[model samples]
Target: MSRYEEAKLNYEKMGVDVEGALTLCAATPISIHCWQGDDVRGFDQKDGRAGDGIQTTGDYPGRAGSFEELKADFLKAASLIPGKKRINLHASYAVFPEGEWADRDKTAYRYFIPWVEFAREHGFGIDFNPTCFSHPMVKNGLTLSSPDEAVRRFWIDHCIACRQVAQRMGEALGDKVLNNIWVPDGMKDVPADRMGPRLRLKAALDEIFAENCPNVIDSVESKVFGIGLESYTVGSGEFFMAYASQHPGVYHLLDNGHYHPTELVSDKIPTLLCYFDVLPLHVTRPVRWDSDHVVLFDDELREMMTEIVRCGGLQKVLIGLDFFDASINRVAAWVVGTRNAQKALLWALLQPHEALKALQDSADFTEKMVRMEEAKTLPFGDIWREYCRREGVSADESWFEDVKAYEREVLSRRGT
Candidate 1:
């Protein structure tokens, strides 16, 4: 018998459906972030100023300087990745027509029509984020929560505009757009009044969501702290969790890199899924802090995906990638992170969840332990190779050769 056939039979004996797992993995769509191409430097303006709370280290060559280059890099990266995919864009990536531009608050759908066209041509759904940092309006590292009414109003208007923009994209693409909002509002040192900023933030969000757009799935992301704002963050997990609970449609986005080192998003996913109908995730690698490292097929990633699979949340959860590492080949970074994400999902799907759960319920602790350990040693790589082959992507490390060739031909031409 063929090797794959033998492996398939082995998995079936363990109550795992290899074909079903491959089918589910192929159908799952992962949202790829655009910032990774340009190092979070968007097309809205040429301010050349670094982001307030967000930062990308290293000045690796071939960072996309314009929209055309970013698009090319993103497409190259997408080509190497397997499974269904979508593009996640930030408001800062908005490109104007006829070299005309509007400030964030007055930004319109015309600026992002090209994105919709590209998505339509490539069969990709779009996700969006309102840029809340690296702007003049973010005075004192506070926006939507700033005591200054004018500053608060500007960000509020900008977020509203972004929502409308996302709503238009969703309507155009015929898929709901996940519009996420992340603010860098926090204090570097002990603040005299923590409640005030959070209260102001709450009020601003209420105003922003006053006019609801069904096509736009609004998600709020909270951070433990940022570079300068290390002491306290206004939008802590508790704050946004409560906000999402109080609101009907709004959802809380858990960025694995956004939490403290001790906190695990793997644990949080099941808890949130229990209470909410839909949960959005930004799968990323965090080293020491929210450094936005490329994801790997590591323990945390496997655990997080396993939880989603165990909870039967493949349909309920929206998965997206959030990371930018300028130190390596940009396209390769995207390929590795995204492919690893798919690997984790596929691995999770391959688990015999029903049998494992039954073993636990029946108090077959020793047998359950043995089964879990044995399943790990199964020919998972063989299954992965077949899936990648079917998906028309490189099933092994051979894909890296393509990335290197692209860099030599295309990326190298973009001189310093």
Candidate 2:
């Protein structure tokens, strides 16, 4: 019998429908971030400053210097990834007419039409984020929650414009676009009045969401702190969680790297599922703090994906990758991270959740432990190979050979 056939029989004994799992895994779409191609250095930066708050390490050669290069790299990365896919974009990635420009607040749907065309060609649903950091308006490590009304207004208007553009993209694509807002508004030192900044942020959020677009799914992201804002973060997780709970339409976005090191976003998934109808997740790995490392198919990722499967969150939760590792080949970074995410999802889908949950209910902890550990050792690689074969992507490390060839042919030709 074939290796896949043998593995299928083994999973059948555990009450898993192998074909059903494969079907589900293929259907689920994972959004890959675009910033990884260019180290989070979006095209809108005319001043040439890399900006603060968000950072990407390593000056890897052949960094995408323009929209065309970024697009080429993005497509190259996308080709190697399997399953249903989506492209996540930032407001800063807007493509404008040559020799023309628009400020953040003035950016309109026209600026992003090229992106719409590209996404449509690739059959990718578009997700968006407002670039609140890396801008001149980020006064005092703040934007939406800035003490200066002008700074706050600029960011609020920018977010409003971003939402409208995302709404238009969704309309053009015939699918709901995930429009997320993340502001690096925080303080480096302890503030005398912590309530002031959050209060301002609350007001700003209210203003930004007051004008809603039906096609857009609004998600608010919070961070514990930023590089400069280590002492106090204006939009803490508790703040946004509370905000999301109070509001009906808005949902809190959870980034795995944004929380205290001890906390796990995996455990929080079910909790959010209990509250929000649609939960948006930014899946990233963090070595220490919000490092935004490329995701690995490691323990935490598997646990997170398992919880997502067990809680029936596959449909409700929106999965998107968010990391920029300039230390490695950019396209390879995208392929590795995206493939790992798909692998984790497939891993979760292969589990016999019903049997395992029954064990927990019956308090058969020993058998549950044995079954769980045994499931880990199954010929998972065989199933993965089969999935990759069907999906038209390389099933093994041979995929990197393509990345290396592209690096020599395309990435190597670019100037430093």
CA RMSD of all predictions: 0.9, 0.8
Clashes of each: 0, 0
The Cα error of candidate 2 at residue 327, in Å, is 1.4
Tens digits of lDDT, candidate 2, 279-365: 999999999889999999999999999999999988899999999988899999999999999999999999989999999999999
Structural similarity to truth (TM-score) of each candidate: 0.99, 0.99
List the candidate 1 regions with Cα displacement exceeding 4 Å: none
Across residues 24-58, which tens digit of lDDT does each residue of candidate 1 receive? 99998999999999888888876643587778888
Q: How many angstroms is residue 129 displaced in model 1 relative to the true structure, after the best TM-score fit? A: 0.4
Give residue 375's error in model 1 in angstroms. 1.1
Report the error of model 1 at residue 388, Å: 0.6
